[model samples]
Target chain A: MASHTNENTELGKLKQKIAGLEKLEQQHKKVEAKLKTVNKQLQASENQLKAYNEQLRESEQKLNQQKEAAEQSREFAESIIDTIRQPLLVLDKNLRVITANQYFYKLFQVSPESTKGNLLYNLGKNQWDIPELKELLKKTLPEFSAVEDFEVEYQFETIGHKIMLLNARELLQKQGKERLILLAIEDVTKSRIYKKELERLNKELEIKAEELQQILYITTHDLRSPLVNIQGFTKEMEASLNDLKKLLEKMQIHPAEEKSLNTIMDEEIPEAIHYITSSTTKMDNLLKGLLSLSRLGRQKLTFRKLDMNRLMQQVLDDFEFEIGKNQVNIEVGNLPDCMGDDLQINQLFSNLIGNSLKFLKPEVPGEIVISGGRVENGCRFVVKDNGIGIPREYQEKIFGLFEKLDPKKPGIGLGMNVVKQVVEKHNGSIEMESELGKGMKFSIFIPD
Target chain B: MKKELKIILAEDDEGHASLIKRNLKRAGLMNEIIHFKDGQETLDFLFQGKKDKDEIKNVASLLLLDIKMPRVDGIDVLRKVKQDEFLKKMPVVMITTTDDPREIDKCHELGCSNYITKPIDYDKFVAAIRQLGLFLLIVEVPDLNNMI
Candidate 1:
């Protein structure tokens, strides 16, 4: 019986050992499934990590490109500021120069390094330290919204004294956190001097016009009274001669004396009367011409829009009879419209064109061209004629009142003077170019 | 029958007055004409201190006035004559060398019978005055004898 118990105990111990080994195998299988799951999760994590690193690299490249574009835009803005021609400067609220344009440096004759970061008044050995500018920066800048046209006449070391118009405005920067001043300077010395000179010349011209008016008034009244007396007595002399001749005829003189008296009455007396009448007529005509010339200054002018083409045609038609008799060819080109007195312009053109027809070579047909062209500050009218031109020496003298080049040409010599008066009254200029036997050209310039 | 009228001529210029008298004679108006050298002399002859003076007191007369006279002008003479009840009946002819339209209008504004512009040409002047001389014979005028 003792031997049987011992064998049972051994069998139990052996079964227990086998059961423990089975438990160890189940634990090992559970651990292997967990390890498989952990390995799959780790592989997924590695793929996600690679994707995250690639996204970070793309973001960095975009940031670098945006930085470069912002840098390029800043350079473009700076270049645009440098291109301004006027002397422009930017200053901080304390009046220290922040930035300046290229013109500022060149105008002040200072380098950019010397200009920037320096006080505006202290720049260039304190040349800009003017009282007006000091008043502007000290009081006007803070009170007014802007400082405009503050004139500062300052003398510089390099350039002479200059009149500058300084304009300034307060500008806000960085969302109103900081304030800046934008100042612009312009030089107007030359224009100011020119305006003063023009005013002086205008005063002189007014005085000259007044003096001419006084002279004209005296000539019109004082010179005409004696002429009238001489004209009236001439008629009386003719009447007296007629009565004497009748009385002598009735007296019954001798044949020899009668023949002598007939010669005196018929030839000598008539010839003397003819010469006197002709001379008086010429004197009367000259006086009348002067009267009319002076009257032009006092006459009221009616200004209206006139078509030069139509006016030329009308003037040409008025002279149609003379033109046909002389076989003169008149051509009119495109003419500009102008504002002027119709009567005066008509007279002007008639005198010029009539001279063209009258002064033509005896056998040659006259040709005249009336045209208008553009000038620099105004319009130009050209009257060209292929006729007997005036001599060069007489060109200027022809404009004088009663100045006749050819005494036998049947003109009172006042036409050219009238033309000059009309042109000068309209503030225009006339130039004549001609040779003795060649063609003549009259160029007139009138402002728009 | 209408009595002949006397002519009162006031002229400042001697030559102009002589030419006018010759032309009036040539036109064949047979009337007595008195001449005054200046405007003051003319006013005295027409309206002397005594209103009734010999030939001019009772007879009807035509006044030929020249403008631009010394001391008193034709316009002033016309004003004075028209204001007088007795002399207003007398016909007045204003003759002058002034051809200004304003002066002609002014003369018409005054009670003048005719405004004649003396022509600068001798022939035209003679013709103008001859027309006036012929007009004097035909036109009826108020008598100064009946005005009082």
Candidate 2:
């Protein structure tokens, strides 16, 4: 029994060894499969890595070429800007000169070598040494977008004197900072001096304007009071005379029958009445015109396009009674239109025509003709009267206040004055041509 | 038919005032003459729907008004009067040097009785006064008691 057991144990050991061999074989196969799969993946990864490396090399080459192109463009643009005739400066973020025009180098009295790539403040030149300029530039940094045109006068140890304007602006940005700045310098010393002179003149003009205003006020006020008194007294005296004459008429007992009454009425009564009436009328007109002038001086004038046809018709209507009484003939031709104040222009017409009727030639019968038409950029108006024409000396004088051509004719000198003031107010000019015996003609040109 | 004479005088200039008064007197106008200076003063004297003041009770025969005056102008005064019940009847004669046609039209629109541009001739003016004075003599003076 012991020999059989020993033999079985040995067989068992052999069997176990067989099993172990089988297990080893299976493990080897599994490991071989894993190695095959891993080798295949490794080959694929190697191919991908080679392709990626090639692409990266191409990208790097393109990047290098782009960088080179950018650098070349920057240099070319800088050279182009620096070639300008005007003094120009290109500064980088650090206020260092990236490029400067030839004119700038000459103007600043700085050598090109020293100015290149140097900080502007450190140039050791008149403009660079200026403390004010430095302070202004430093304070105005980055946000400094205003175009300064003020004159800057620089005097230095080396250069005699120079005047310039510093005009600068932020040109470009890069890397979250100002990349470039452009500055232009212009010389305006003479113009600055001229502006200062202009300022001085403006001050003088203001003073003169004030003086004129005060004078006008004083004159209007003083003259108005006296003129009022004169007008009052004249009317009172005339009225008293009229009352006496009327009293004589009512009584009908004083030697004047029909013929006698006719003689008195025609000769003495009419003559006296004419004197008193004309004188008072003239004075009244003067005062009223003066008042109007004063009002004009005091108020702001409003002007607009005035239809001449409408304005003249109305003015002529006002003269209906006077025209009828004087037996005067007025023929109005085609009137030109213009922009003007209605009231003032109407006054102008009335005064001119009224003047014509007043200065009548003896026994010739008064007649007036108004004619005009449009011309280039304006309209022309002519007033021709068949009355005693004005003398050359009196023509100019006629426009003056209280100036009259004929003292014998009862009129205040205000008629022509009104005409002139109104015409000028309308932005027009007036010219008068007259013969002492024939008549007077006035031409007025008003711009449209 | 003769209309009653009642007159209003609006004048700011002292000389204008006296001249007007004297001429009215020579015209032998016994009708009441109510006078005021500035336009505002004249307006104040006439407006606010109040009954005519005792001096203006006759309804004013004629208005001899000047256009340029301190405070308010004659044009303003005339405008106010024409808009009123009693004062509009009075003939408003613009007796100033300004013969502005617009002023005449405005006066006419506002119911002015007439507009007379003050002429520079003293004698002619007296004659104008004489004519108006003759009208006054012919016109019956409105009795204040009978006026509305």
Candidate 3:
């Protein structure tokens, strides 16, 4: 019986051992399943970390590109500011210079080390500290946001007296940042001096012209008085001689004495009277010419818009007889209208045409051409004639009073002078070109 | 009754005075002529009584004045004579070398009876004097002595 009970216990223990083995196996299986789940979770977290690292690298590259572009833009603006020609300055709200352009440093004879960050009034040893500049900057600039052509005349020890025009603008920064002022300077001293010099010269010219008129009046009047005396006395002597001859004829005279007296009355005395009369007449004509010249200054000028073609026609008509006699060929071209005095212009044309007619080369068929056209600020007229042109030596003297190319010519030698005077009165200019014995040409410019 | 007319000639130039006298004589003017070399002498003789033996008072006189004289000019003499009560009745003629229109107008404005520019030509001068001589013959003279 004991042996059979021990066998039963052994069998039970074996069975229990087997059950424990099985449970342990199941727990190992459960642990293996948990390991699989944990592995999947870890794999998902690794993929998420790799994605975040890629995103961070892209963001860093984008930031670097933006930084390089900002640097390039700053350099571009700085280069543009340096290239400006005019003296330019950038100042802070406190009126201290923040920066200056190349032109400003060069013009002010200063360097960036000494100019930048310095107060505008203290720069160049306080040379720029002017009262007008202070007014413009402190008072005018605040009211007007921008000031243009604020003139400041200052004397610098190094640069001498300078007339400057200052233009300033308030540069308001974005987002209510600090404000800056942009100032530009211009120099106008040389041009102002030129204008003053021109005015002084014009005044001197007017005074000289007035003095010349006075001299001409005195010379003509004083010379005419003596001329009248010579003329009167000559007539008296002629009358006395005639009376003596009549008295002698009535008396009985010796033959030899009568012959001598007849010679004196007929030849010597008459010759003397003829010479005296001719000389007096010549003197009278010269005095008349001088008087007329003096009177021209006192005469009033009446300006009119003149048709050049019609005026030229009237002048030619006055010389119709001479033209027909000489058989001179005249060609009238297109003429532009101009503004001048009618009577004076008429006289000018008459004198020019008359001169051409008077001096024509007798051998050639005389050809005269008159033409005109519009020019800058005026009209230009050309009067060309095939005539006995003046010699080179005598050309310069033609416009002077009483100057004659040929002394034997009939006129009093006042024609050219009169022409010049009329042209000057109209604010016109005249030019003459000629070759001796070839032709003569006159080019006149009269304002419209 | 008409009083005999006398001529008073005031001229600064001796040659001009001689020529005028000869021309007047040729024009058949036989009146008694009195000559003064300058405007001052003429003013003295006319305003103040003459002390010379040939001085005649209370005569009907005609004045021929030349401008541009020494001392007092002819314009002053004309102004003085025209202002006087008795001398204002006498005829005054201005004969001058100045033909300026302004001077001619001034002379007429000063109450001169006639203004003549002395022509430089001898023939024109003689003809002008002859015309004056004929005008003098027809003009009725007022005697200064009869006034007041």
Candidate of highest DockQ: 3
For every candidate, give the share of true A-B contacts it also has.
Answer: 0.07, 0.38, 0.31
Each candidate: what lDDT?
0.81, 0.72, 0.84
Q: Is 1 or 3 the stronger prediction by DockQ? A: 3
Can you give the lDDT of residue A105 in candidate 1?
88
Chain A TM value for model 3: 0.57
Rate residue A317 of model 3 by lDDT. 97
Candidate order (lDDT): 3, 1, 2
Is candidate 1 or 3 superior in lDDT? Answer: 3
Task: Please tell me how candidate 2 rates in CAPRI terms.
Answer: incorrect
Window of ten residues with lowest summed lDDT in model 1 chain A: A220-229
- Number of clashing pairs, model 1? 0
Instruction: Write one digit per residue (lDDT tens) for candidate 3, span A406-431.
Output: 88766788888988998999999999
Q: Is the docking of candidate 1 incorrect, acceptable, medium or high quality?
A: incorrect
lDDT of 2 by residue, A43-146 (tens): 99999999999999999999999999999998897787677657888787677988788788776678778887998878865247677666556667455654
Off by over 4 Å in 3: A1-95, A98-114, A139-186, A250-260, A300-410, A415-448, B1-120, B125-148
The docking quality of candidate 3, as DockQ, is 0.30
Off by over 4 Å in 1: A1-208, A252-272, A305-346, A349-400, A423-448, B1-14, B17-148
